[model samples]
Target: MKQSSTMRLSRLVFLYAAARLAVVAGCAGAAVAGVRLFGLEVSLTWVLLVGVLAGIAVSLLALRRLRTRINDEIRIVDNRRQDPSKRPRP
Candidate 1:
């Protein structure tokens, strides 16, 4: 049904967002820790910037499967919208 598809899409979006945020946070924490461990002085802004950039790069490789699934689900929903026959009956 359209409702189920929409719900699934929503769930996937939530999961992706949570996963991305966790990765970014983890990377940011690591960046801060690494700086302290090496006794290197760096601004918080620069460390956070590096963390966010690294998180994006890591997510591209790590979340490819989840991203593909999300894209496929989006295409399916879009197709259903364009074709009345594919739309669920109330």
Candidate 2:
């Protein structure tokens, strides 16, 4: 089955959004865990700094994945656009 350009773009957008949301939630959860395990003795600044770092790491990973996915999609679109016969018959 062939995919339309709009469909591919929509899928990429959804995947990107999901990845970002997951990363943010994961960072928040980790920060909460650190607080619970380390207690109040640890400074809030340190915990938040660590959490922010983790979030940045997660965003970087997601960015890489997004880049790969976008590249693949662009390749597919280019190939489809180049092959006229592959397009659906009206």
Candidate 3:
């Protein structure tokens, strides 16, 4: 039963990672798309700069989200531990 839950959790983690990568690529593509729409000449430097910036932005947001979630979980655990009924009696 534990193994089944671990596997499911791992699958979700992998999918979320893949989705983030796709988002970074999509942001880069959007930059290129904008250039093409305006009939501007494509530049390698421009594409790379835009892509790198987008990836950094996404990574920072992800880290902030993860940190917030972890903090919230810790509070939940601490609150549960502080409850008298939930405590183990010696």
Candidate 4:
């Protein structure tokens, strides 16, 4: 049997969280490397903070996109399950 929309949504949310974490970590690492490689004077704390914020923004955008797509499918499924007659004609 296929998973329920709620379960699928939960999985997608978890993946979105993991991706955000990775983005934050990668950005921080790159910032640190850039500072060291070029002998630039910059605070690691600021760099990491920026990275985290950017990651959050990116994740929010992705989440919105994913939610929109999944919601469309979920709605269609619910409509069909609740009342066959209510479903849109193909």
What are the Cα lDDT values of the candidates? Answer: 0.88, 0.79, 0.67, 0.72
TM-score of each: 0.91, 0.59, 0.51, 0.62
Q: Of the candidates shown, which would achieve the greatest lDDT relative to the real structure?
A: 1
lDDT of 2 by residue, 1-90 (tens): 977886987789788877877887689678978798877676767777788788878877768969688778888788888999888788
Candidate 1 lDDT score relative to the true structure: 0.88
Better of 1 and 4 by TM-score: 1
Give the clashing residue pairs of candidate 4, or none. Answer: none
Give stretches of model 3 more than 4 Å off: 1-5, 59-90
lDDT of 3 by residue, 1-90 (tens): 344333444555565567667767777877877788898887967876787688768766865665455456556557757788866579
Ranking by lDDT: 1, 2, 4, 3
* Pick by lDDT: 2 or 3, better one: 2
- What lDDT tens digits, residue by residue, belong to model 1 across residues 46-83? 99899888988888788889999899889888998999
Which model scores highest in TM-score?
1
Error of 2 at 6 (Å): 2.2
**Which residue window of length 10 is worst by lDDT in model 1?**
1-10
- Positional deviation of residue 81's Cα in model 3 after best superposition, in angstroms: 20
Stretches of candidate 4 above 4 Å error?
57-67, 70-90
Candidate 2: where are CA atoms >4 Å away? 41-53, 71-90
> TM-score rank, highest first?
1, 4, 2, 3
Cα RMSD of all models vs. native, in order, equals 1.9, 3.9, 6.4, 5.7
Candidate 1: Cα lDDT at 60: 79
